[model samples]
Target: MITAFLHGFLLALGLILPLGVQNVFIFNQGATQPRLIRAVPAVLTATLCDMLLILLAVLGVSLIVLQVVWLKTLLFGAGLVFLLYMGWSIWRSPAGVSQAERPEPFSPRKQIAFAASVSLLNPHAIMDTIGVIGTSSLQYDSPDKWVFTASCILVSFIWFVGLAVCGRLIGRFDGSGRWLLWINRLSAVIIWGVAAYMGWQLLASA
Candidate 1:
């Protein structure tokens, strides 16, 4: 049981540890506008989306996704475009913008919606949860599968909460705007890198 739990945790970490679009956005929200109560909703929504994907994966639905040729290409193309757009947006935005200038404040519901969209729109998240985590869970028994699922859920909750809190802490700093700009730029670079890699993978497979 303990080993199974550990395995699940590792699997969850493998999927979530990368600085993907969702993570980058969460960190930005946390670090820049800590006072925005909406950030918590966003984080929780993202976590829930991840849990849902894991559920689908555990149910063996991921296999169907892998079997489809056009679906894979479509997903890859969408992800590439999304990541590139995000990167370009971040690159174009000025980091020194005040919190007041950050645009309309998100309501709690809207924050969750935004988070969900940010998480679920990325096809790679689906692949990671359904393909990678789902396949990994098969090594364990039913009980172990539960343990693994639980571990993944725990990781999601902990990671998002920690990220939100850290962002708030950073926002409290006086010169945080500069830091936010740097972070945004860093996120752009990471997103572009991921986009390039995904494009390459798709090309190789083709």
Candidate 2:
């Protein structure tokens, strides 16, 4: 059990530590929102989405779904489209340092939508969850499996909250908003790069 717990925690932490579209979106929300509380919707939505994916992956449901060729193609296509649009949206967002020049914060609805898109629509994230965590669970059984699942889920929740807090701290300290502007631009580039990679995969699979 201890081994399972440690394995799950370490695996989850390693998988999530990478910089990705999902991470970028959550951090941007935390930094751009007027208050940390305003970023709760994004934080919660992303965490929940991750929890769902982990559950599906561990239970082998996602593995079964991935067996369908058409579904895989569909996922890649949809993910590519949304990632491109999302990249554009982030890149164009205003980076005003002052309250007057700053654009309005995203409403809870928009935050939730974007969070879900980044979480669920990205083929790379889904593949990572299904490929790594899902396969890793095969090493355990019964109560141990459940323990592993719980550990992974717990890591995800805590990590997302921590990310939001870190972003908030940076936003609070960066009075000039120059950092935020660069962050947005960089995030957009990363997202677009991911989209292009996915597109290449889609074409290869074709």
Candidate 3:
């Protein structure tokens, strides 16, 4: 049981630790409007979505997902577009814009919508949940699958909450405009990198 839990934890980390669209967006929100108090809702929504997908994967729906080549391709393409658009938006935003320039507080509905969009529209999330995580779960014993799924869900919740809270803490430092600028830049780069990798995979599979 201990070994199973450790394996599950590592697998979950492997899926979630990458700098994907969701992570980048969360980080941006943290840096830009850390005080909005909506970050918790956003993170919680994302974690819940992740748990749902993981559940689907564990139930063997992932096999169906893998068979739909065109659907996967379309999702990947959409993700690429989203990443590029976000990257452009971040790059074009004023580097020194103060928190005063930030938008009004995000409502609960808006936070949930943002989280759902990030998860649903991201091809990598699908692949990670439906392909990688699903495949890993199959390697475990039947009794251990539940343990694995639980660990993955826990990891999602912990990571997102920790990231959101840490971002708020970091954003509290005054005169950190340059640091924020670099984070935006880094987020943009990570988005592009993931897109490029996905494109390469799509081409390679063709």
Candidate 4:
């Protein structure tokens, strides 16, 4: 049981530790929002999406879903387009604007929507969940399997909350928002890089 728990915890952490679009958006929200509570929608939505994906992956459902060629192509195409748009949006968002001129932060509804998009639309993230976590879960059985699944889910929840909290702390110190502007630009670049890679993969598969 201990081994299973550790395996799941480490595997999930390893997968999530990378600076992916989901993490970037969550951290951005935590920093830009007026208060941490305002970022809860994004945090909760992302965590729930991860939980759903992890559960589906461990249960073998996502593997079956990815087996469909056309469906997989469609996922890749949609992911590419959405990521490109999201990158542009983040890049253009008013981060370093003066306080009087700065636009309002993302509303709760917008936060949830964007969180879901980044979480669910990215085929690369889905494939990673299925390929890594799904295959890893096969090594366990019954109660151990459930234990492993729980451990993975727990890691995601804690990691996202911690990420947001850390972002909030950094935002508190950066009163002028100059740091936020750079962070947004960096996040956009990273997101576009991922999108380009996915597009290349989609073309290669054609």
Best by TM-score: 2
What overall lDDT goes with each candidate model? 0.76, 0.90, 0.74, 0.88
Cα shift from native, residue 194, model 1 (Å): 1.6
lDDT (10s digit) by residue, model 4, range 1-206: 99999999999999999989999999988877778888899999999999999999998998898899999999889889999998898889876556543324788998898899899988878989999999999999999999999999899889888888987887777777887788788889999999999999999999
| Span of 10 residues, lowest total lDDT, candidate 1 | 98-107
- Models sorted by lDDT, best on top: 2, 4, 1, 3
Score every model by TM-score. 0.82, 0.96, 0.81, 0.95
lDDT of 2 by residue, 134-157 (tens): 999999999999999999989988
Clashing pairs in 3: none
Best by lDDT: 2
State the local distance difference test value for candidate 1: 0.76
In order, what is each prediction's RMSD in angstroms? Answer: 2.9, 1.1, 2.9, 1.3
What value does the lDDT take at residue 115 in candidate 4? 92
Cα lDDT tens digits, model 3, 86-161, are 6666666566656554433346676677677778767668767877788888878767888888998999998887
Whole-structure CA lDDT of model 4: 0.88
Q: What are the runs in model 2 whose C-alpha is more than 4 Å off? A: none
lDDT of 1 at 27: 77
Supply candidate 3's per-residue lDDT for 150. 91
